[model samples]
Target: SRPPSEEGHSVDELCPNVRIHEGVNVSNIMEVPFVVSIQRRISPNLFAHFCGGALIRPHWVISAKHCFQQQRSIDSYRIVGGTIDSEDTKAESSEIADILYPDEQSGSHDIALLRLKSPLTIAQREDFQQLKLASDVAANKYHSCHCFAAGWGVDSLDSGQPMRYLKRARLSMKFPKKCYEEHLYHTGNFPLYEDPSLYHCFERGEGEDRGVTMEGDSGSPVYCHVTDGTGRVDAVLYGPVSFGYYPEDANGVTIMADKMTYTSNPQIHADWIRKNMKQ
Candidate 1:
């Protein structure tokens, strides 16, 4: 079903509803190997959708469980990585065998495992790399460091169209307490505050340089810069983008969006994430 702005709708719509708002366009694949685009093939002549994901292992991806709320068949998804371009046929696209959910009802556990139907074809190509999941201690280590997020999200606030071009944005981490106060999303079975295992992140640059997560950016990973065991600076997955706030204009239409603190809280669910990494 299309919004009032749209003309009409089709019974089995092939379009996807999903972004990185105020993000820089990226072309070099090596710069962000861990980023992945989740797509759905609707019909024979239909367009494949562009969603967000992260490559965490040879045969697995980590994404927000709500991404699958559409509940399309697992086989309908095509996981694209290596290159940011969605139409680039040369890029590595793999099969989605199954989607594992920690809690079927969704509740507090919003993260999910995207088990690939086949292992990734990394070989000599350095463009496809496995991302490291961050522990709570590891997340704290990069408290003041620069963090990042990438996606093929929405182009602007006025459209449901995908950016097509891969984009990344620098984000500032928000404290859990402050995030709770800001969003006040903690409610009923999905109370975000009572569960420390669930947290939030937001882009807090001042002035005209603000950014936010959009419709298509769900399940995208929050990356933090952390020093590896050998003291080398490395990037690790902080969590998956869960939800955000959408502010409206005076006319009751959406303006620029905000409030991105809600996430899967990777630090708090490390044990569950590890146990279900490859399965």
Candidate 2:
């Protein structure tokens, strides 16, 4: 009975309200090697939506860019490379071979790249791990990385159900004019803080249980892990799950969600992935 924006959230801004109970699950974690999960069948009466990709080589694949600008091309997709259990994936087949978004409408340069027709059998290679794209990041501050988000969202959001197995979350890293001064100035809509290309931000729960990005994880891949002398994958590919900044409500308490969750900046497509990835 505390919903009026959780009584104006002051419990240190809030971010871990719990409330999962049970029903839809997806957290095998495999002990973090290299996460990848991008499912989209788009047929047989819909129902196959999940986004979250990264595996920078062995035929490339990096996502976001509104996860493919509403499809209509790229053969309508079907890629499900390694890990993130669709059933213990030893390679369950989803062999897509081409897809690239980002013509303009630059919401900080979304992001999308996928090419895999063949090349991916180094015998599984310990479940894949190949990401290295940080073009000397610098714009604002705050960097404490460790991002790995496998999708099939909804472990709790009141449980809409659809979390089969492939869920991992541990995010923290905020910058981008402090995410446009805390949640894009309550979303006045567009023009989020003078377009600082290659966007970045990741903070969790700060006003009635927050810390967002769910629902198939919208082209996920906001990574980290760079030990200076060649450690690899420091930044690139962001935004997916944009919504939050609940000032507050009232009555019989119906919070449902709070704020702080934004990603969408894959290095402004890095020149559209060097003019269409294939390297």
Top candidate (TM-score) = 1
Reference-based lDDT, each prediction = 0.66, 0.52
Show model 1 residue runs off by greater than 4 Å: 1-23, 45-47, 104-107, 123-129, 136-144, 185-193, 206-210, 228-231, 247-261
Alpha-carbon runs more than 4 Å astray in model 2? 1-51, 54-58, 63-85, 92-150, 157-162, 165-247, 250-254, 257-261, 275-278
Error of 2 at 105 (Å): 21
Q: How many pairs in model 1 have backbone atoms within 3 A of each other, for residues 3 or more apart or on separate chains, i.e. clashes? A: 6
TM-score of 1: 0.77
Please write out the lDDT profile of model 2 over residues 1-279, one tens digit for every residue: 322222354221222322221222334443333445666665753425466666566566676756666645665666555555644435544566777667665334556677778654432576544455555454223232334344656666667655656655545566577777665556665555357444666654232222455666666565654332222234333544433344445674534444355666665556667667645
Residue pairs whose backbone atoms clash in candidate 1: 18-215, 18-216, 19-153, 19-216, 19-217, 200-261
Where does candidate 2 have its weakest 10-residue lDDT segment? 15-24
How do the residues 1-279 of candidate 1 rate in per-residue lDDT, one tens digit apiece? 322212233211212111123446676766677788888886853345456877877777889888888867777788887777876777777878888877534347778888887766652365554566665345433322446777877877579887877777766777766776555543424545454446665754432324566778889887765542333455668788887766455797755645354567776666766887634
